[model samples]
Target chain A: MTEAIQNVANPQIEVKDLNLWYGDKQALKNVSIQIPKNSVTAFIGPSGCGKSTFIRCLNRMNDLIKSCRIEGEVSIEGKDIYGPGVDVVDLRKQVGMVFQKPNPFPMSIYDNIAYGPRIHGVNKKDLEGVVEHALRSAALWDEISDRIRSPAFSLSGGQQQRLCIARTMAVKPEIILFDEPCSALDPISTAKIEELIMNLKKDYTIVIVTHNMQQAARISDHTAFFLMGELIEFGKTRQIFENPGEKSTEDYITGRFG
Target chain B: MGLNAKTSERIAFAFLTLAALTVAGFVLFILYYIVSNGYNAISIEFLTEMPRKMMTEGGIYPAIVGTIYLIIGSMLVALPMGILAAIYLTEYAGQNRTTWAIEMAINNLAGTPSVVFGLFGLAMFVKYLGFGPSLLSASLTLGLLIIPVIIRSSEEALLAVPPEYREASLALGISKWQTIRHVVLPASIPGIVTGSILSIGRVAGETAPILLTGAAYFLPRLPDSVYSQFMALPYHLFVLATAGTNIAQTRPLQYGTALVLLMIVLAVNFVAVLVRRYYRQKLKI
Candidate 1:
């Protein structure tokens, strides 16, 4: 396993020997990686290779599954996220997530963006400004700014994904995780999300788990390839895609196998 | 293959349609019989007057008020408790042995007979608690009888809200309780309200619990306190049909009382339907 992390000073997220299980069925093996600040890192692998599970470990989403258990150290910004006296709510606020499917609340578009802020105790007077800023940041402001009060379901799938991104940004989180966010979207929507993600790197660190290898090649600055719960190789996206680092990484990315 | 499949499909459709119409026909026939026999006896005087001439010729004013009170009291006891218990079970309870046991217990409570509830109410609320066969005792009994229904329906509603919503909310750093109050509970309103309305109908019509707990054969006037004895429509109809001085003479009056009871239940249901629709539109789900 080539886990040599290159060209990084002060990594935003660092993991060490992370192992996870679902009722004794090991889902993630000893995996470690260091993700730099202000960069897009993509995790690509075959189905059930634990790429999605690895992404969820960042925000501790696996806590919701009753049978899921973990034994490893995951740190964000030099703080152990899986440490004692930590609140999942507070950690999630700092590290937000966008799911595979766009899940807008059963409320208005404006309300969807404002949900995070309101729950975080943002003043009623400042909510409009916060919602607009988040929407503008997500690049969805120009399209549906006129109908902010309409139900979120009215938006197209791609637009809903942008709305979700906007929803994540509303709380001003420093890190955002996209878990196959474009899987449910069409290519056009996927392209738009890709563009939005590249532009977002200037302000926030992004970790995306995508099945599409071409998508990883197109958007990510750092690429990590996994095969069945173990990290195969981790390095610059260009080197991983173009040059041969590991035989499986070469096989997995060249359309030989997923 | 096509013709045989089509024939079977048509037969199934017809069978389902016939079953539905048969049920509807039974209901319509009951409504028609009640109206035809009771309409002649209904008058302003009959609705307002107290019984006269050995309970043979008068109105059921107190019974009407008593049923309404019972309905309100039972809701007061059941709605908040049922909804909160349901929220606790679905949102807070871990998937473990305790939750499994509670789930089994709730299912059993739902299948228990209403008369058993009446008997339990008699012993617990009436004798042990010293509430003494009053409206309080009956209201508590009916509330307990229908609480399982509310909890089950509420659990369904809560579960119907996709796990994604809860995840989305939690992902935004919202606490569990806040996620439930803001997202989960609001989305499940229609299901919760519909379930509660069905329970309300059962409470309004049930006679057994009230019979052992609160209902009287005839009240001089409306019972002023929850502790006082009351006259309920189902129990009133029961007395008129079996224990009245002239059961044959008051046959029309029995139907009238039945008609009145049906109308009250329907009227309550109508209001609940409007509320459910209003929430549906407002939430736009």
Candidate 2:
């Protein structure tokens, strides 16, 4: 754990004693972790283990849900995001998110990518370039450049998911949160998104929630294991997968118990 | 011990065909009766000219213009208020006791009798506001009458928009108002237009509200302003059919007016269907 923390000089996101509840039911229990700057950190847990809930808190997506209550500090770039006077809109701009399912707006593909930048009031002079850049970053520009005006729903399922990624990238967020982004994709599309994530690490800090242990081991530099609302272990991806410090982490990675 | 499968299948087919033909036959019989009686009087003179002094020679021009005025006026008043109320109910208001109560109130308002609305409109707009028995007063009355329909339909349209769209916009750091303006409203425009058109159809055909608040006699000229008195098709037909002294003489004019009104209503409905189809095609891509 110390070696993993030492490898990265500057951390991008530091969550301290974060707890979340949905009315009377608690979802996350005192989760604390440091995510390194410009590195991929994967959260691995079974379904309903609060991994998705924790990611939603990073971008304030949980705010829209009724009966959701979040506690403790979640900070990005040394600023506490949940502190008083924090504008959730500004926080979301800095921290973008992709959902598990592909949810393109019922509009054209160009509009879907351009939507974020347009809302944030990006100048018209720069919008065309920005949209192109985002789509390119998501590795979807080549297939879609000729027919950008086509409706987004015309795209294949994998393509739609990539378009969602492009939409997130258009806003130029510092940190991107992914909630089981590849869970709905096949092996081919999943591999493509994984490759895109690896490339994206050079520019954006990524926090991913994935049920696939192999995916977490393959793409993430740092990994955190969660089970039943508790953070069981956190370490370098290599260490966590190869030789975990805790028995529970080993058991989960080895398919002993989810 | 075995059933005759082929015979049973033939019997079922025969029963289904008979039931379908029965409904079709009833509808066609009513349509044939209305059209044969209404179609003979439809002509250029019967459409463009006003009712003659002798009560036999002219058309339903005044009533046609009055129906248009009443429908347009009602739409102008009801559409904005209905959309705003729907937005407040669905987007801003929490799903609590107050919202539930409001929803219940609107549903009951929709179920209220048209005559009750006419009485209410007479008391409120005519007696209290002193607008008089004019086009404006009638329009206001009809507007109140159709607001419940608009509210219910617009709310349903807005609700039809998936929750994922809102979540996506919020996750992109867009403000709630901005999200609704750019995404939700644009997607729901087809539904809104359909609802508005349906409400307008109701306004055109409504007779009770107009009877309570509008001019009972035919006006030679079109209404010059919102407050001016005007003759509507429904009121004109009612008078021509029932109260006119020369019933045998004015019967053609009455049938002509009814036909024109039916055509206008049908045209409006056709346009709504076309608009919906256009939007559906656009949304499919």
Candidate 3:
């Protein structure tokens, strides 16, 4: 597996010997993988598997959990994120996240996009351009450009989700993590987001966690299957969907069991 | 079983509607009683002139000024202290046994009787602290009485702010304090302001606390400073109705004072309703 993955250039994020516990219960066990630069990687698994938990560990989102305990090294661009003197706040700036729900702040549309830039102390003069560029990148500018001053809740659910993505982009993050980004949207909205994700891979490293197998096959370059706190298989999306390496992976993929 | 369920549902709906109507009826009854007895007594001179004849012959100007002073003074002390304590309790405090105990204590304090707070104020501020029976003492006592109310509501307001906002802000690499200032506090402002206004209404007409700490029997001149003894609307009404030598002659004045106090409370409540409506429309929530 190492020889097969070594042919590619140095991966953007390297995870090794990762283990996690929620108080007395173990949630992730010995999970290790490499994420390539500027590509889409999908973590697909059944519910209660550690796929969501693993994705959270990428940017230390799980640290917000009171009982969560982690033991492993996760490095982004060769620097160990858990190493001494590293600030979690600064680390998150490089790795943005979109939650399962469309969680736009109950504020103006313009204010929602400007929140990140304002936090970073960006000049007022530059915020207008930044907001425009971010909305344009998320393919949302044409729909919402005229009503930028309106409250974010005025947007449709799908538009709100895209606004969230644009908000993540406004911070200029190198990696964007989506935790079931389209689970709340209809099929049409889901298709649009999938297209956006494919186009986003040209400049940003995208990591998505999804329960939908078709979505994983549609947009992902690499796919990792998790089951009961263990990574069963990690390979190209096409190979994993066509010829899974493990029995558990094939059984789960073929609808034998979740 | 279906027939029984239908009858029971109709009975419950009727009972609930009756209960709501009872509340509306009580409010209307009070408004009618106050207005009928007090409106005839309300004149420009009755409002602006100083009381005479050892009881009541003129306006309650001094009491009105003193009430305003006390409200401003107490709010100066209570608002910031209560808000800060609430923020500490909700935002920074760890979820532990100690936090639970503190919350329990605050809830119990809010339920404590008004007169008990008066006793507390008399002992702590007037006697021990040597503030004496002056405007400062009365204001401080009232401030303590209302602090629990403020803390309870402010904590609720802060908690009502969605956790998702905090998560999103932190994910953008914003510090916890910055997130609170820019996102959490802004979103929660409507709740906080409404809570403060409600508390203000409760504190405005309070007589028990001020009766012990300040509430002079007769003061023709306005309170010149915080240290000066003062009269207040509720306390003045109490004097005219019960303690006055000419009780029969002062009856009209007592009703007038009560009406004014009620109007002030209604005005504060009206402002709170307006603010809530405006924000609800703007936020669309």
Candidate 4:
């Protein structure tokens, strides 16, 4: 436990020998990686490569699926989250997640940001400040501060996605997981979210699953390449993209075969 | 163009128009018939006063009050149980054989005859529980009759609430119960309320169930409590239409009661339509 704590002091997440299956189909296999603290780490892969599945495992979102079975050690802040008696809710609180599609709750923008804090018992009096701070962190407050009471659906798709990011930030989670956050947005919106993600790493650890290699190269400090549910390569983003050591990595990044 | 093809296309178009007009004409005919017969019987006094001197001398106040009581009473009994059962079916229960069986049972319950439900109510509430022939027994019978309807509608409403809402709430680390309370219920409220209003309409027009379990013949007063004996519109209308005293002189009274009963049923259905429209408008925004 003490050694685990030492490892976590410098890393936000540590997964060891992780494997996952959905009924008879294995989605991940013997994957191990360290996500460093206060940095952006991007997972780049083709669709169905288990990038999203691995991140969902970080917050225990896979537990919601009936046939899903996970085997491995996933620890956050040196505590093994998969250990017995560990509260999945607590784990999720510390590790917030944003999904592929922008899903703002059917509510006002202010309420969307306040939802997380309120659930975790943030005081009503302090809620406004939290909401404002989160919106500002997500780079959305300047655009939406005047219409915080408007329904979130009123926002453009890009703005709604940012509001979702703001909602995750409002909970003050230590780690934020983005599952293809930019996949559904326009180029301008994608660029905006990418910029916001880069800035967010100054204060929070971010793990993003993205298919855009240029995005991983531009914003991420480290990148992990996954294929067929296996972690093919992991290293500095510049090293992986500019001069990949593995032939498969070279072929994929060079647009040979996704 | 081939003559046969062209002629057949024209025939098809003509038949389609005829079918549309036929439906419209049928609806208009029914409305005209009801209005032609019912217009003269409707009066302010007919609506506001109770049946007097064996329904020959007064209005349908007792019947109106009784219908209201029946609807309110049935809704009070059915709403909680229906919503809870819907929640269990949609959110908690897995899609297993048992859950499928329960769903089939609920669907079958919805299709059961109203008279059969009346018999069940008589056996269960009036006879076994010894509630006597009173408002309570009548309400319980009607509630049972409508519970399946409410459950089916509520389940559909709950299911219609986008799964994304549940995921958003759960992803925020909200407990499942809290997610249901804060997100699922609020979104489903309009649907549930609309379904309940529809169930109220069913209870308002139901005559067979009340006949089996409620008080018989004329009652001079409104039900003062849940357990009090009461008069209802459907039973009163049925009795006046078929077996009222002073048949020649009391024909107008019988017509008035029938018109009043029709109005009550229409009013309940109209309110339900309004509620559904209101929810749809809110959902659009």
**RMSD to native for every prediction?**
2.3, 2.9, 2.3, 3.3
Q: Candidates 1 and 3: which is better by DockQ? A: 1
Cα deviation of A192, candidate 3, in Å: 2.1
Cα displacement (Å) at residue A56, model 3? 0.9
* Chain B TM-score by candidate, in order shown: 0.96, 0.89, 0.93, 0.88
Model 3, span B1-285: residue lDDT tens: 356988989999999999999999999998999888988888888778788877559898888777778878888888888988898998999989999998898888888999998999899988999988889988888888788888888889999998999999999888888989888887777888788787777778899999999889998888878878998898899888889878888888888888888887777678778887787777666
| C-alpha lDDT of all candidate models, in order | 0.93, 0.87, 0.89, 0.86
Q: Tens digit of lDDT per residue, candidate 1, span B95-182?
A: 8899999889889999999999999999999999999989999999999999999999999999999899999999999998999999
**Which predicted model would earn the best lDDT?**
1
Instruction: Give model 4's clash tally.
Output: 0
Name model 1 segments beyond 4 Å from true: A1-3, B1-17
What are the TM-scores, per candidate, against the unseen true structure? Answer: 0.95, 0.93, 0.94, 0.93
All DockQ scores:
0.75, 0.71, 0.69, 0.57
- Across residues A57-87, which tens digit of lDDT does each residue of candidate 1 receive? 9999999998999999999999999999999
Give the lDDT of residue B232 in candidate 3.
Answer: 88
Number of clashes found in candidate 2: 0
lDDT of 2: 0.87
Candidate 2 per-residue lDDT, tens place, B73-147, comes to 888889889998998988999978999999999889889888888888888888899887788888888988888
Task: Evaluate model 4: give its TM-score.
Answer: 0.93
In angstroms, the error of model 3 at B190 is 2.4
Give the Cα error of residue A25 in candidate 2, in Å: 1.3
With a 3 Å backbone cut-off (N, CA, C), the pairs that clash in candidate 2 are none
Best by TM-score: 1
